[model samples]
Target: MMSITYRLPQVRNLVTAFPGPKSAELATRRKAAIAAGVASSLPVYAADADGGVILDVDGNSLVDLGSGIAVTTVGASNPGVVAAVQEAVTHFTHTCFMIAPYEGYVAVAEKLIEHTPGDHAKKVALFNSGAEAVENAVKIARIATKRQAIVVFDHAYHGRTNLTMAMTAKVMPYKQGFGPFAGEVYRVPMSYPYRDPEGLTGAEAAARALLLVEKQVGAENVAAVVIEPILGEGGFVVPAEGFLPALSAWCTANGAVFIADEIQSGFARTGAWFACDHEGVVPDLMTVAKGLAGGMPLSGVVGRAELMDASHASGLGGTYGGNPVACAASVAAFEAVEELRLLERARHIEGLIRQELGDLVGAGVVGELRGRGAMMALEFVKPGTSEPNPDAAKAVAGACLAEGVLILTCGTFGNIVRLLPPLVIGDDLLTDALGVLKKEILAAG
Candidate 1:
């Protein structure tokens, strides 16, 4: 028997079906919540979580393959994380760092500078979410370059804020009818290798993008070219090696700041501290948030000292940007990553996903299998056709959920099945989750 501490996370089923009697009763209350627009895509109602399994209020245990949208790299309900949160909660809940400031905030910033890529003198500004970090990165760029135009890429997802909405690309939910966005924002075609015209290498793709920027937007007038080193909401797009380097070089040559939105790809998600490390192309600035606090709301823009200092002293702060409790949690999370050797686990996770689902790509049911380390996806399509098969992907995902595993869908076409399990998941648990996922993909065929 697993210890009580460890056993709660293991798969244990007592109810007749997934959402047992107790969960059904609470779901009625949740219906009221849904009426208020608070319900979520997954309705398991986590009673507890450890390792990788989330125990629902219904008494069923399902694997958490999504990792709360890649925020919990060190696992949900980790003992260390819980202890750190509880300790901080007892001491004080919220004292706005901008008002009085505290060591917790200072410590987290130190850790951010230490962990974030680049060996140059660095500084950090904390925020509440990925969107806020993106907005702040924009502010830093505009201030540093004294330019108004911010450049974004196609199919990108920066945030929901007015400014980030302008930077974001997709139209339906993110931009639909939410017009009058922040001004001077421009769009560029991202080098999504899977969809790019045949025979276009990464370098050629970057050169084409730069030429477009120069011709249309006048690169000299642009303030920043914001990019996700590994595109997150846009199907985990991993540009070939030469792509980022070329883009960064272009930004440097043109006097535009290169802002790497590392919110989704940073913190060892892609087998590196930041995906930009894949090509040794460090950005002038970087934004991070999702996994920084191991689930708490804490994010920061860490970058070159000169650039970070460029902003006026009081121009970059907010009331709750860096709460003391969240900062404490972030400190613990940073410590956990190094002490737990979680980077190796991320690489191991990539291996497991590839080993299990790789043959599906050749079978042609899968359009592509892409991404790095733990941040991976299997994009589905109509067999022998390039068209996306979102319906088929949905059916497969439904099957996985029914079989007691949770998987998430992504991609511009909504045909990609992404796997982002906790980096600390047990090997046996990951093997079981992948086994279920493989069965569902084949069944979808």
Candidate 2:
């Protein structure tokens, strides 16, 4: 069992209604100071968080099912991460790894090599966020393959940067009004088992996508084939079995780097070191973030040695690519996962969530219960039909929040309520949160 050392109480307590006076006042102030485009799902203002509970300014402790969007797998205030960050800060903050190399950066790279999929000689490049890691991954692939075209899957979300926005599938929020995206970024069909045509096997799905790739953009011109092993923003959509392996094989044969964007699914979130490990699919390049540093902003691209080294000297780096504090936190985060055996915890959480929500499917309150390990989701749909019921999703999330549980919703159609509870959450707290989720989901019906 993971040791819980944070001061914040683990229990969910609703001392006042959700978003009480203090939080409502803060929301008003935030509206005045913050940009209109930026949005928050819940109105509650977090004062402190630990383990599975986020203490709001109004003295309400909300069960944190979202885990800061899956960035806090080891918990929001893991003791190891806190100690490491503090210690690293006392020594020095930033020397900019590019200007003067540091041991923390190298150490993080080494750890990533050991943890990410594949046993082959691999190299790593650190970055500040998932978007930066993805951008750098594409850059590396393009330079290494000497090609310009990059292939992305339908409903894939790479990031918010210019190039990544171009690669992303959604339009209304991510890409709308951001015109003239990066060139030569092609999109192909994804193996979304729930949404794909009936009876399409994983190999068949790969063939369909490959046929499109061959017909439209010659495989020779493709630099990278980027995909989320288990789609994150795309509704936690786990593709059909063998889909990843087929894609990997195709990329190897076609000279296109298979980039697994395991930003949300990495770091033992999917009951494994990485989701790609589930299918024995070793990606040529893997971009990771989110759970890397126990809520610290750090991302990296670990890949085969040749592809990483193909870049010219000083071609890949940023001033804060590998900050010492973030690196230290990342090292501690990895240790916490290992020490706590979070992979098994994630699987345990998955089993609990599936068992708790299983009845909703038969009741017509859920369309699908999908995803792996701690990264599970409930796709709300119109009762007795496959059509998306985004309203039901919204209702369920609102009901959960009102009752002191924080859940997040995501999907191409916005009908998925993804559950990403901290792996260190106590069994009692997890069960209680799931109970709240179940009540709200059924009530929505």
Candidate 3:
């Protein structure tokens, strides 16, 4: 391992307003060029970022807690990632790995085989986004299994694309008018422990779900059962222990593929290399993106060699499937994660979150504190019931943004607040961000 140094100076704000004058002017112009209804979570624009801090274009500096939706675990504006991306861009931006074939892309694929969970022989196919990785995964699964029905769990968010919209469970924003979705998609109940019936353990849920799948779709008809190791948009739902293992076992026996959507949970997000690694249950195929290339547009499908080879030659690939510049950044990100022991750092983040925020479940501010490692969330609820408190959750996020900390909310119920901080965040910086969150929660009620 080699030592890497990066600088992140927190410059004081000179303007009275958070966004100041310049950002406001830019926001007005943004509405003209961007699509209608498009919005941003963090209003304050970033002029620069390094490590755990965000330097706003308004000259306001704040500690970044969201890590751009868990994309920059090695930290925003990472020195190594920057250097590697710079060098690759200088050489050649894009020849498309599928066409010209570049080492940078090959390097990323090699890392995926080396780092992604499972000791089995695996192959990788690159893509542009998590959704792309997911869409491509389904294509491969259907091609391999010769089955049309793709089974996805309820409350899952595969993507915003047409096919994925049909797979996505949310109705309000993701799938309201975006009708006439892709065919052959089936939805099933997710193993949500917080709201599940009493007396039903994780294993029980698996049995029930398996029985349902067997009954409705018929195991042979289903191509693949797509799952998030820890459910992402479904409020960071951590299925009961043994639940995922049982599901994977059922898939294996039934001859249906288990596709772990680790887009949000993979690449050392949840304390482990992959959330499935915690249980030692490997998926037949997996979708990865989010933090794959330190914020560049890069995703991939890594699966058993035979399964991946199932697709006929030239059946899988994209024009920009493996952009060289993005692949270069991915190499740096992987090296940083390995050398910095980010897996251990993620565990420490889990401890801090469970301590400060998890304690609030009893205080009525939190109904559920679920998830693993850096990929944790707190669900707000009206006291003494399972009813969601979406307003309170939204308020908490709003207050955090006002204080210059960005937090994201998810869940089909829209009552869960999630944290996806950088893996390289300092102990004090992380503790302070958590303290800010605690204060807002306490003040909300």
lDDT of each: 0.84, 0.92, 0.86
Residue 227 miss distance in model 3 (angstroms): 0.4
Which candidate number maximizes TM-score?
A: 2
- For each candidate, how many residue pairs have backbone atoms clashing (under 3 Å)? 0, 0, 0
Tell me the RMSD of model 2 versus the true structure.
Answer: 1.0
Ranking by lDDT: 2, 3, 1
Question: Ten-residue segment with the worst summed lDDT in candidate 1?
Answer: 1-10
Off by over 4 Å in 3: 1-5, 10-15
TM-score of 2: 0.99
The TM-score between candidate 3 and the true structure equals 0.97
Candidate 1 residues lying further than 4 Å off, grouped into runs, are 1-7, 12-14, 34-39
Candidate 1 vs candidate 2, lDDT winner: 2
Give a tens-digit lDDT track for model 2, residues 93-187: 99999998899999999999998878899999999999999999999999999999999999999999999999999997999998888999999
